[model samples]
Each structure stands twice: as C-alpha cells, then as structure tokens.
Target: MKHLFGNRVIRLLLGNDLLDNIAIWIRNIAVLFLVMDKTGDDPVAVSLITVAEYAPIFLFSMIGGTLADRWEPRRTMMAGGLLSAASVAAIALAVRYGAWETVFLATAVSAIVSQFSQPSSFVIIKRHLKEEQIAAATGLGQSMAAIFLIAGPVIGTAVYARLGIEASLLLVAALFLASTLLVFWLPRVPRETDAERSGGLWSDMREGVRFVLRDARLKTLLLLFALLGIGTGLIQPLDIFIVTDRLALDKEQVQWFYLVSGVGLLGGGVLAAVTAGKTRPNGHWLVAGGLGFLAVSIVVEAWSVWVPVTLVSRFLVGIAMAFMQTALSAMMIRMIDEAYVGRINGTLAPIMTGTLLAGSALAGPLLKATSLLAVFALAAGIVAVAAFCALRLKDRPSAVEAADRA
Candidate 1:
C-alpha cells in the first residue's frame, strides 16, 4: 500500500478522482433538487435530468474513446476538465439570467466531456502503474467511489440547502477548474506512435470493434458487461418498490438499503486493495464468485419480506459489486494492450449502457405487466447468466506473465 501511494502519478490520479467525484455528486444532487423546486416536483422535469446526464454516453463515448487513443492522455483529460468548467460557468450565468431551464445543459456537457476524459484515465493507469500494482490501484480508486456513495449525497444536500442553486452551480464550476489544475500536474507520457495515428476515426473505431471480437477474453467480458447492465437496470428502478411493496415499509426507508450497501462496498474495496497482489491473476474467478453471490443476493432480496433480510441482502450485493468492479478493472489492465485500451473500453461501454437503458425502459412496463417478484426473478436470472459466462472464462497469461516467461 505504501509502495502504491508513493508513486507520484498514482497519487495525482487518485487526488483528481476524489475531486472529480465530489464535484459530480454535488452537481447531480444540487441540479436535481433545483429542478424539483423550479418545476414544482413534476416527474417529467425530474426525469429529463437523467436523460441529459446519460444521453451523452450513447452519443459520444465511442468517438471520445477513439480520440483518446490518438490524443495525449494528459492533455485529453485537461481539455475535458476545462471544457466542463467552461460549460458549467456558462450555465451558471444563464441560470442567473432566469433561464433556469438551461441547467440541464450543465449535466449534459459534463457527461459528454467525461466520456473523453474517463478513457484517458485508463490509459494513464496502464502507462504509469506496474502490473502487480494495477489491482491495488483499481481497488483503491473503487474505495473512493464507495466512500462517496455513502457521503456524497449528504454533502451535496448540505451545500445546496445552504447556498442554493446559483452558488451550487458556481461551486461545481470551480471544482471542475480545480480538477483541471490538478490534472495539469500529471507528468507527460509518450504519445501513440505515428502508425497508430494514421487511421481515420471511423477506421480506428472499426479496428477497435474487430480487436474485441478477436480476443476471446474480451469478447466474454463484453457479454458479461451487457448481462450485468441488464440485471442492474431492471432492479435499480425498483428499489423504492422493494421498500413499499415487499418489506411493507415507507418508500423513504430505502435510504437504509443504500447506507448498508455503501458500508459493505467500503469494506469490500479495502479488502480487495489489501489482497490485490495475490488475487490479481485470479480476477476471473473473483468476478465469477462475485457475480454468483450477487445473483443469490438478488434472489434473497426478491423473496424476503423481512426488513433485516432485505438489508443484509443489499449489503452483500454491495460487496459483490466492489469485488466484481475491482476484478474487471484488473482484468482490463492486465489483458488488453495499452494501445487498444481506449477503443476497447469505448466499444464495450455502450453495449452495457445500451442494454441498461433497454432494461430500464422495459422495467416499468414489465412490472405493470407482471409482478415485482417476476421482475426481480428475471433480473436475477440475467445476472446468473452473466455469472455462468464468467465461469467459462479461460485463464490466459497477462502481459506481465508473458514477459516473465520471455
């Protein structure tokens, strides 16, 4: 752990991640409440916020990723941060002019920029960290996410409640600016070779698709991502119903589930970080185990009317999520060539996003058409299929292992 943190690049990357996430959570919550207040709690207006945030991933992720491959990682990240800050500042100004509805543009612009910046982070991770350190780094990063899942909402609510919309928007803009400055300190890394840059954007994208298709491991991971997305999407929208319909509790009580799950995720991430070196090579097994456990948890959550049982199931689900995320990150770093990392990530991401959106779109209709039990059962079944896919993953030598043999 000391060794990992001692690396200057890792420290900078993690610090930037921390700042970025804090800003995002603050922005998301503040914008959401602001919209609610402005629109008198109209559900359609509230839902549009979600659309603005996620719609960009569908539109720009692939292109952004392809560009990340051709661009310098450090510069790409810096550009994204700067662009986000500028857009948010513009939105703040617009809001001040009583055009408050344009606030959705803030979320949309940030989300669009993130698709470009996020893949650059993976490139930096691949370039800076040693093979053995990758898992620990990934785990530590996830730990930060876990922490925020627990505290971010509270912090965002406090800020917005105290400062209100205009201040909150300005604060978000400032945070993005701060993040950009932080990224500016990252050491410059070598750019992609001239040969890599020679291809046109569409050509590069096509190559990325072919690259994933040709790798059996990557292909399997892609399928697993799609299944997990579907499973998660189906259940995510129904959490409140789990409280209201299953546990016979108030919808407001759903917070307890999130709280317990966040706690479990924090513990699981720390455990993964501590054990990463030993477990990195066996990530496929970890992923499989995590998915299997998650599937069971979902099943338990589905049937159990008891509050304690459901809470415990949700907690276990959090732990499973941490382990699966850590394993997936380790696998991506270890398995894929760095040159194709951005393109591959871009390619695989939309499959998951597209499937998740599809599943989310289906969830309400499915629930209305059937029952809560049926919807949960279908989600569990999808995740179980993903677990089975993970089980079928054949172990292969990572670049580090192959190097040692050579």
Candidate 2:
C-alpha cells in the first residue's frame, strides 16, 4: 500500500486525473446552470445540454479505443490532453465573446475530445501497471479524480458567484492545460501487437466487438455497466427538477446539493483505496452498490421528496457510485486479455453514451407524464436489474499483471 501510494508514476497519473476531474465537475455544473439561466427552460433543456456533451462519446469512443491500441498509450493520452485543452480554451473564448450558444457547441466539441482522451488513459494504465497494482492504481486514480469531483463543484460555485460562469470556464481551461503538462511527464507505453490488429478501421472495430462478445466476462461487465448507467440516468434529471420545482430552491442551494454528494464520493474513494489490496468481492460489491443506489433513489426521489433528503440521497448515491466505478474498472482490467483491452473498453463507451442519452431523454417525458417519485422508482428498478446482471458474472482469480504491452 505504501509503495502504491508513493510511486512517482502513480503520483503523476493521479495528478493528471485529479486536475482533469476538477475541470469536469466545474464544466458539468456550469453548463447545466448556464443553460437553465440563459434559456429559463425546464430540466429537460438542462438534460439536453448533457446529451450534446455525451453524443460524441457514442460516435467516436470505439475509434478512440482502436487508436489507443494502434499507437503508444502515452502519446495517445498526450494528444487527448492537448485536444481537451484546446477545446476548453475555445469555450473560454466563446464565453469572452458572449456567444452562449457557441459555448454549448464548444462544450460538445470538448466532449468529443474527451472521447479520445479517456479510452487512451484507460489503456495506458492497462499497459503500464502490474495486475496486482491495477486495482490499486485504478482505485487511486479514481480516488484522486473523486477528490476533485468532491471539491470542484464547491469551488466552481464560489467562482460562479464571484466572477460568473465564464470565470469558471477559464479556470477549467487552465486545469486542462495543467493536465496536458502532467501527461508530458508520464512514461511512454507501447502499442498493441499484430495479433491484436484488424485489417482496417471498420474491421478493427468489428474485431474488437467480436472479441468482447466472445468473452463471457467482458459481456457481463458491459451489461452491468450499461444497466447501471440506465438506472442512474433516470434519477439524475429528477434531482435537478426536484431542487428547482419541488423544493423551490435557488441556484446557490442546488450547488450545495452537488457539494454534499461530492463529499460522499470522496468517502467512497477512501474506502476503495483502503480495500484495494484485498481480493475483490466483485459480484457482491456490484450488488451492494446497486442496491444502495436504489435505496438512495427511493429515499430522495420517492419517499421523503424534500431538499435535504435529496441532498443526502445524492451523497449516498455517490458513495455507491464510487465503489461500483472503482471495482468495475479494476475488474475489467484484470479480466480482459492485453490484445483486446483497448477495444473491449471502447465497446462500453457506446453503451454508456446510450444510457446517458436515455436518462436525459426520459427525464422530460417522465416528468410530464407522472410524478418525480415514479421516475425515481423506475431508476431503482433499473439499478436492481444491473445488480442482477452482476450476479451472472463468472468469478475468476485475478489475472497476470497488466504491465507489459505489445
């Protein structure tokens, strides 16, 4: 544990993830608030903002994953970092020009850049670390990002209050630049071998998909993750509307709800870091996390139906979310073969993108048709399905170290 925490490469990687995460937190909250303020529309409009943001991940994530396999991981990551920085800068410039709609467009462009960044980052870790260290590294990386996720909203809120959302955008852009710099210091990682390569781009993607489908473990993991995404997607939009309408809360107060959840996220990360060295009870944790998330959804979205309860629900959901994400990513890193690791991961991106879109799209119709409680109940049921999917995974001993790449 000491060695894991103290490694220089670990420090570098964690630092980069942390800054990028802070930027993400700021960017997410800022965009939603900015849209609501400018448009004065309902929660549906805010959700649409997210849809635009994630649409590219659906389109290009597999391509990004294939590229990660074909190229040096460090170089891929560096390029991603640079693209993210440039996109962030573009948003800042748009804000400076008072081009609000253009800012949304730039935000979407930034998301597309992230489609390139994340798959590369995941593959880099998969290529570099030992299998034993992979969980610890993944946990620690997520933990660092969680820390930023925990803190960034509060900081962004303060920045938003003092200097407006544009100022927050500028700060986020700066963080991306810092992340790019950290990428510069990261160790180089090799590309996948000829055996891993497919005939052409489309063919390569097809091969990756075929590989994932053939692997029962990979298929199960993707199913669980997709279900999890769908369950949460239902709840996320409700949280905003609950705060805005049901609770009749102001923007500042809503930011506090985000802050509370961030704290829970941090706590979950601590737990993951502490448990990293132990044999993972992967199926158990998945079920527990999913159930916990379901419980939170019920409490906030269904039963209590109040602001404080919603905030607490967000926190509890964050806790469950942290465990699920850390465990699942580590599990995937262990289960997949080196050759198809990038592609296998890439395959999940579209699933996530689809689920996110579903969540955003459903928020509107559901809110219009029924009560918020019904929407929340729907989330809980979806999450239960995710947990059930996890039960189907075949538990296996952790694999060989994830260190060497082709």
Candidate 3:
C-alpha cells in the first residue's frame, strides 16, 4: 500500500482524483442547497440539477472517450481540470449574482468536461499500472472516494453554513485548480499502437458498442446495471426532501446520514481489498447481491420514519454498493481487451445515465401520486427485478485472479 503511493505518477493521479472528486461533491452539495434556498427546495428544481449532472455522460462520454484513446491522457486530463476550474469559477460568480439557472447550466457543462476527464483517468491507470498492481490501485481509488464522499458533504455543507454559498463555491474552484496543478508533472503516455487503432471515431464507437453487445453476459450485466441506476435514481434526488420534509431532520444534519453510509463504504472497500486475493466471487452475483441489499435498505428506510433503522440500512447499502461495484470493475478489467476499455465503458455511460434520467423523471410523479413509503417499495421491487436478472446472468470467471475461485 505504501509502495503504491511511492510511484510519482500514481501518487499524482490519485491525488488528482481525490481532489477532483471532492470538488465535484462539494459542488453538488452547494448546488443542492443553492437550489433549495432559491426555490424552496422544489422537487422539479432538484431533479433538474441532478439530471444536469448526468446528462453530459449520456451526450459526450463516447466522444470524450474516443478522444482519450487518440490523445495524450495527461494533457487531456490537464485540459479537463482547467475547464472544471473555469466552470466552478463561473458558478461561483453565478451564485453571487442570484442567477439560479446558471448554476444548473454550469453543472451540466462541468459534467460534459468530466466526460473527457474521467475516461482519460481510466486509460491512464489501465496503461500505467502493472496487471498485478491494477487491483491495488483500484482499491486505493475506491477507498479515497469513500473517504471523500463522506467528507465532501460534511465539509461542503459546513462551508456553506459558515462562509455562505459564494465562498463555498470559490472553495470548490480552488480545489479544481489544485487538481489541475497536481497533473502538471505526469509524464506523457503514448497514443494507441497501430494494432490498437480503430478506423475512425464513429467506427471505433460502433465497434465498442458491438464489442459490448456481442457478449450475452455483458448484455445481461448491463441490464442489471440499468436496473440499479433506475432504482437509485428514484431515491437520490428526494434524499434532502426526505430528510427535511419527511424525517424532519435539520438541513445541517443531513451530513449525519452521509457520515454513517460513507463509513460503511470505506469499510466495504477495505474488506474487499483484504479479500480480493482470496475470494473473487462471481462478479454478477456480487452486483446482484448489492442491488438486493439496496432494495432491502430502501424498504427498511420506508418501514418507519425512525432515523436509526434508516441510518443502519443506509450503511449496509453503502457496504453492499462498494463490494458490488468493485467486483464489477474487476470483471471488466479481467474480461475486456485493453484497447477498447475506454470506449466500451464510455458507451455504457448512456445506459447508466439514461436509466437514471428515466428514474428521476418517474420520481416526481410517484411522489405526487403516492407517499414516500410507496415510492421506496416500488424501488425495492424494481431492484429485486434487477437481482433476478443478475441471478440469471451467465458470466463466468474469465480473469486469472477471479478464475482461481472457479
């Protein structure tokens, strides 16, 4: 673990991801409270902000991933970080001006920039790390993500409460700038080899899509992925409302829920890393199990308005989510050829975001027509269906590490 950070490039990139993720989370918290303050936390307004965050992944990830394949990862990432900083700065200015809509606009644009940034990071890690080192690097990344996801909301909301929205957003901008600076020293990685090249961007994209669809198991896995997206998307936008409106927790205390679940996420990452060499359970089952756990959590949260039960269930949800996603990623690393890794994952972004969009769209109507408990039960039912599909999944252990279990 210590040696992993000893490598200069890995250290820098990991720090970049850490700072970038924290910046994004802080921005999201700021956006959530900003809209709430401006619009009285209107459901439609909140949904729109969340949607804006996801829309670019649907629209631009393929183009960005294709470019990532063709360009230098470090430079592309640097450009992305600069754009992110500018976007945050623009939003900070927007906050000062009371231009509520521009906040959403800025969020969407930043998301578009992120489409480029994320793929480049993926390729950088895949290319730079040795095969054996990949899992450890991934574990490290997830661990940091868990930690930052926990801290971001707590720190971000505190900043907003203490310093005001404008100052908090400026803080996000500073983090983005810091992230960009960290990448300045990363060595230039080479472009794809002749054998790695696809004919053109469109052709490469089509090929990536084709590659993903050709495998029945991959198709099945994506179906489960879509289900997970839909089920959770329905839950996420309403969380603040559920806290303040439903559970009646103060806005400042929302961090408590995040704290509990984030601790679970960190613990899960640690547990998975400890077990990775010993137990590479079938990836599909892990995902299915995770979804099932989320379903159970939703139901538990809905069972009573009592906060402690909901908190514990949410913690379990975090643990389940970490284990599931880590398994799914390891499967991808093991099964996919290196050349198409960027594009294939890129194309899947739409599948994820699109279903989430559908789920978000459904949330408002569900709330209007039914109670929160009903909505959660519906989410549970949807996730159970995903789990059934996962149970039907036929993906075998193909990666050397995972295959050892088989």
lDDT scores of the candidates, listed in order: 0.86, 0.72, 0.75
* Ranked by TM-score, top first: 1, 2, 3
Q: For model 3, how does the per-residue alpha-carbon lDDT over 1-406 read when each residue is reduced to its tens digit? A: 6666787878998889888887777778888898898899789999898678777887898988777777788899889888878887887787677676778876887888878877787777777765545556666677788998777777778777887778777888899899989988888878866577648778888877887787666677678678878988888766766678667789887778878879888877766655542444454565677678778877887675778777888788787767666655655655555566678678777787788878988998998899787888888898899887877654443343243344
lDDT value for model 2: 0.72
Which has the higher TM-score value, candidate number 1 or candidate number 2?
Answer: 1
Q: What TM-score fits each model?
A: 0.94, 0.80, 0.79
lDDT of 1 by residue, 228-267 (tens): 8899889888989999999989888888888998988987
List where candidate 3 sits over 4 angstroms from the true fold.
Answer: 25-48, 87-105, 131-136, 157-171, 193-198, 237-255, 304-307, 367-375, 391-406
Q: Write down the RMSD of all candidates, one decimal each.
A: 2.4, 4.4, 4.7
List runs of model 1 lying over 4 Å from the truth.
Answer: 193-196, 395-406
The candidates, ranked best first by lDDT, are 1, 3, 2
State which candidate, 2 or 3, has the greater TM-score. Answer: 2
lDDT of prediction 3: 0.75
User: What TM-score does candidate 1 get on C-alpha atoms?
Assistant: 0.94
